[model samples]
Target: MAASKKTLEQRGFHIEVLNLINPLESMSYNLLQLIKDAYKQGDTATAQTLCNTLSYSLYYNPNVKDPFWNNSAMSLCNALILAVIDKCIEEKTEDKICMYTVANMLSELGSKEIVIDKQGNTKNVLDIYFEILPADSVAKMQYATSNFAKGGTTRGGIFSTTMSKLSIFTFEGIAKMTSRNSINLKRIGFGKSIQGKGTPRVRVQIIFPDGSKESIKTDTEGRFELNFKQKVKKGQRIHVMESETKKKMIVEVQTINKDTGETTYKVVEKQDGLQIENIVIFEKPIAVFMIVPDYDSSNHVIASIFIRQLYFVLSKYAGLARGGKCHREVVFLLDEFGNMPPIDDMGNIVTVCLGRNIRFNLIVQALPQLKMKYGDASTTIQDNCGNQIYIQSGNKETAKEISEKLGNQTINSLSRSGKGLSIDKSKTEGIDTKPLLTPTELMRFQEGESAVIRFMKRRDNKFEKIEPFPILNRGKTVMKYRWEYLGDDFDTDQSILDIDIRSLHEYVNPRDLIIDFFPKQEEESFEQPEESNVFVSEPKPVPIPSEEDPEEPQFADIDEDIEIPEEAYASEPVSVYESEPASPFEPLTLENWKHKTAEEFFETHRSIWNIIEKQCMRQWNKSLADIQASTMETFIDELKILVTTGEIDKNIYRLINGKYGEVMDSLLEKEGVKEEV
Candidate 1:
């Protein structure tokens, strides 16, 4: 009984054990009483039978059944189902249930069960489900745990606010350090006061390098500080102009420390890369920090916050570099990347950071996780990566995608046919295409094995070319690192003091810095007005020549030698050079052709009218009126001469009449020649 009680306690069945003990106690007392009665009645057989029945009942009590105590598949299934139900109840909420919520709950339960049985008779329920779920689904569940769905602004609000404050503080420190020609003050105070009070507000204007201006006012203490939300880069000048009249004076610095027996005198110099008094280091350096959560941690909300803060800091550094080459390369190796909140503008960074020597090595369990978080943008993100290494994947989809990307190769296929009785045989060869690596082969790769697709930019024939290469190799083996176990040392001091806070506030003067950029008044220049002499010239009228003047030759006199054949002007115009009389055709005149409603007029006159219009316009440099005023006799003479010389075929009229009669009429009308027939 004691052993059974201990086992029940070990298996976390304390409640069941208590219920069993309470019932068994009463049963035991009743059994003793019954045995005594049987003995008194001289019935030994009844007492023995009663004892056996009670013993069997105690051993096989259904109420005290423990799944952990049983070592069988059936017990394991029951335990898993009950565990899931318990988790569901514990995490019940008004919001719609998500797959990730269930997955996380199941994972936690599995962990506890594993602790209870180091060598379980069945596989873990969480592991089984993980393998079954698609990669993207798993990724989304992991992303939800980081609380990124709350929106980027909300998730990163705290970090952004804190960084803004720090940047303002740092800017003030830099101003103080760089103010070489400023007056030193023994003490300075900045305080805000109620409006309409005794203290007066002073307006100050700040002009950024980009020509954007911001106006601010001093507090009751005549001191002011500017807080900027956007990131500020190095060498970005800020011009401060005081609205009120203020005199500028150079300040000197002198320090004496009686306690340290030291005396110092120095002048601040104009320079860049000013350090933030104590917290931040201005020099470039490599840094690494680990972000780990406890095994049973509910979510990675805190870790995600830290990561977001780090991203902002890196972004500031990148901004300082001004999108140019970075002084040093910065690389972020994010392990279990899907488990963190999505970083803002991560896609932009991935696409452009490589040129600035900034790189991100994101490690994920599967590609689906990435796709879940990025959605359609997942493809763009993957495409921008210069190199991709795909290790063995249990996911058929992932393997297939990778295999297809590896490309296809042609192979020889052979086929043979034979009939034994006829002794006839046939053979054929064909070409077939298949992927470089089959999906099955890709998935079957052993541990430490990977297929790498590297896009290398190399100069070929003086031109840069990007080519991809597939490489298969085993990854380097690494030994596990461990530290010796040690008990807590209460006496040891682990505190670190890296910077002195006293020096930060020693020489700050917001008032003097504000006055440094005061607008200076320039003397206005007044020159004597130049003497003005008015000169007006009399207007002269130019003579206009009349069209009928003898100096202007008539169209007939311009080319009078050309002659037109009588047949060309006959009622039915005929080609003069043709042996047979030309077929009757339509006129090509501007007015008659414009009114001609026939498709043939357009087809036949289109080319000829184009030529005539171009020639008239070029010869006279005149408008459409000049083309109308020209004599039709001159055109008819030119057409006859062209036909006689065979330059314009007479058969052209016959063909135009048969195929496009109205076109021929439009052409003749456009040339100012009347089509009588």
Candidate 2:
């Protein structure tokens, strides 16, 4: 958030940020793996939901009014999923597709990614499409005669793999161009490698049934469709020619001699080749994808998908199921809350996020905007929020709503009347109630004046109602911004702190909060996966247990013991803090604590020992302070664990909390720590 990276460095925060538009290179988020992880955990629902979300992202456009496009998009999305799956299973490879890859792939034949099939085979995704496009007339006629595929009991098993991909090739009976459409007519050869024909944007030639030719260039994902005046007839010829070419041009001349004279001609032709550049982009810990106001609109789809995924991840990791609060908290500060797409079922998320340590701060012009976005659930979302800040705006509706919520304040009114200096004078006093601030007055509030409506405020793990009040900028109306208050004496006329207001929004990818899944992206060099075609040798012999070496007890399926590799286990337990002892040490137990001297006890329980030394050693150098309640709890917990190590003779935690002062006095007196009062 600070302008100076150097200043942020001094404060111990590494800044690695990227905007939303071009996030794929920097994010390296393996969405493919995330989907599989959900499936692996038997949460097939979550995996399906992710697929559905991607489908919506693929077809969503704020401007579009047609629902048909959205439906078609999901169909296309599933096809892409199957395409990727078949490729991975055939090749016996793991998933390497990411969200960015998916984004580009959804538009075309998707990327050539690795997927794992149940039977364990690796594959090239394009080859699955290659199967759809039969090589010669014989293969083509055979496929046409059949209904897409040969029967295998039912319509949706191994044949379903072919079913999803067929959607990509034919939309209204006309097949489009794909990476696998040509491949130099060789499904597998020197030129058919994923790298050789990998570039999505390639020159291609399409030959129609009428013997007419059309050349259409594809987008980065090699996505392009044709306008079919009529549905293509069955058994008709539609040919796609791969025209991949190198940028290098070769110059040649052709000289022809005739009766009149010899004519020399020069021509330039592109070299028939392709260049591959595999530049690896490292992943960043922080990424800020700005949802532009114009609604670049596509970003909303991406943001919505990202936010939903983030909530899913956080809920699983730190929600009530986690048993306790996480070490760190995640906060979403969303501005223009209404402009963005509605986060699905956000009302439920708002109501139950407290214990999870996940918070959402929504900023909007008024309540109506939220209502527009989330419908009736807007009320649930708003009411669940414990705190609300209202600043004066031109909208009288919002002002009136706040005024009514503020209620009425009681006041005493006194009236005295004496008409013409007559001897008699009458005075009347009465109590009455009136709105704290009328709608008109509320709407006319000065800048920096704001009303705070609060409820169920938590402090010390207890809930209390906070009275609504106005934050009047110290004295109601006479307020200025930090920069204006600076009086223009400072350079740039801003505050002393190096703050970059532009970059203040800390839009962290929720995955960054916990996951470190891709360490490969951190490498400074590019490396290819090792390829091999080899077989494993015979298994090593096992040492059977004899009567002298007692056999282990038999376990049920899941409880069965498996041998772990020697290198897998750590030799020693690592300490939490950097300043811990270099040599190995065991925690002191109650049995040893009772017999040991103060010096020996302190050495073993060094957590307690270090604090004593810090106070005694640095008293002259710095101010000595009592340990914080939190730090004390940690030390006492350590002592309790040691007490419970082998046997639990007593409740160490309660004993320590209750008699700590007396114990401290005795221990200090024995250690010769002189008292000062």
Candidate 3:
């Protein structure tokens, strides 16, 4: 019997242990099951609550062996709690939640609360933490205790704020004594404030050694991880600009101290380039002149009068030098350009110059003497007689000689009027037809028009007239046209006009087209019309009152029978006889009242009787004239009753005295309180 009792006691003790451990475990199992159901069904808050209960239960579990159990359970619970919290956060983004505490809990947890898709087979929560820092004791401890609350530390770095179109400019200088280069440029993520979608473009400009500038533009997302693209040196300046009309910003370059690791950055101030005006630059000087003759001078007469007369026709080309690629300061010219100095002693050339880019050339209409005196090879072929133009020439030999020199032939005799025969470049057949000139040669050319010329073909030594392309001696090129420069004869330059050469690619933000929803407009157009018949329908109508009532007393019996005349009763109310109540010439004054209280006033003017009774005025007064003017016998009697019943107080007397001063005067005269004032 003793042996059997001992065995029974041992069995009961085992059962007691099982019971003690099972409830906590069972409760946790039930809570987890409930949470799993909530999580699967999308009941996030319920899931979070069940998780919290499980965590608390785990904390209290006496038989629990894992020291990390509370943290692990709390992490799972917190994740669900935070996920429920995250929804609220996403909705209320500005709300603050303990991210660090949550992170700590997750780090302590050995497993993650998040589920992974089976097919993709992503790393679970614990896997993520382990992958980042497998040997990190603190992190491992956090995960073990808080269930993966630590998360992947690699991804956890900085906090973001709500600022749209965020742009960051990093300024750093490597001060450590080493050969390593450290300065880099980059754009971080959008600020937390950047809510919508758009292609944000960031521009970076770097000013390096020798005052040279380099610029690069970033793609969408405002993210640019900078590595060394070029050599870095000392005294370099870097600038980054965020170019959005709504969020225009400039970020300055900064450097961090090596020892302290302290960094500083300043907001950059940008100047508007377009607003700057009248940019001017000094250029070298060149000569400009029109070849006109001293026609009447006999001593200076040339062999051909027509030759001298044609000088002006070719003088128009003088301005061509001013429009060339070389910069021109000024164009100085007489009849000849060869007379000018080659170079001034100060290292400045003695030729005309414009901006650094303008083209410069010299033009000269010289006689043999002038050519022999100052002409050089650098004077340009066109400056010589190569571009010489010929008009009417009386000498056939001179004309033939000129035509031969120009690679043209004499067609006919010059003996006839309006007809001259010579050979020159034929613009039509790309050959030197060497055609003779008529009145057209003497006419001035318009701006849009140009003269065509067939130059003598030098290739193959062929005597052919080649029609060169009609060059606008004053126009510009394609590149110069990109930037608009609006002034002078610059219109002729192709370089000055923005001609379409290629299709344009523009980066545009998508949110510009989105419609904002706040403060939405209400639609009032679809209101329901009221149904008149539904409310108007009556069930039945009463029959007309019997004609008998002769026995009933007439309403007239109650009325005062002392009517003076029908005309008197029919008369318009005395208010009609009076002009519309005159506007107060001045503010109302109590000095106008003769009566002590308002009751006397209503007794006089019954038109104001309702007002007196409505105001509960016990003692009222009115001017004598006003009392005589209205029917007030009933009003006075009613007011007297109110006073006798003790309804009138000193306050009422004061109110009457102050508010109805004009009416009180008549009442006072009737009462003989005092002479009307």
lDDT of 2 at 363: 88
Best-matching candidate per TM-score: 2
User: With candidate 2 superimposed using the best TM-score fit, by how many Å does residue 536's alpha carbon deviate from the native?
Assistant: 33
Indicate the residue-level lDDT of 334 in model 1. 79
Q: If ranked by lDDT, best first, what sequence of candidates would result? A: 2, 1, 3
Candidate 1: Cα lDDT at 300: 34
Tell me the lDDT of candidate 2.
Answer: 0.42
- Per-prediction TM-score to the true structure, in the order listed: 0.32, 0.41, 0.16
**What does candidate 1 score in Cα RMSD to the true structure?**
41.9
lDDT of 3 by residue, 23-129 (tens): 11110001122333345455565555544433332222223465343344444444433342333233342121222223222333323232233243334443443
Better of 1 and 2 by TM-score: 2
- Whole-model Cα lDDT of every candidate shown, in order: 0.37, 0.42, 0.28
lDDT of 2 by residue, 561-633 (tens): 4342222111223232325665343433322333334443333233433333332222112122322222332
Where does candidate 3 stray beyond 4 Å? 1-338, 343-357, 361-363, 367-370, 373-380, 383-402, 410-466, 469-677
For model 1, what is the error of residue 394's alpha carbon versus the real structure, in angstroms, after optimal superposition? Answer: 1.5
For candidate 2, which ten residues in a row score worst on lDDT?
A: 183-192
Candidate 3 RMSD to the real structure:
43.2
Model 1 over residues 1-677: C-alpha lDDT tens digits? 22233333344331111111121111111112333334334455544443332222212222334521211222222222222322222334211121122223333323321111223333332333333334543222322322232344432342232222123112333223222211111000001111111123766554554667655576555544442322223334344445664411111224433222132323233222111111111221323333244352222332343343334334444453334444456666778776554454456668877776668787766777667655566677777777788876787778888898788889999998888776688999999999889999898887667787766534456686745567777546322222222212221232212211122223534332211000111211111111111001100111112344323212222234543232221123323222444424453343343343333233323343433343333332334444344344223323323333333434332222222333333334444554322
Question: Among these predicted structures, which one has the highest lDDT?
Answer: 2
Candidate 1 accuracy as TM-score: 0.32
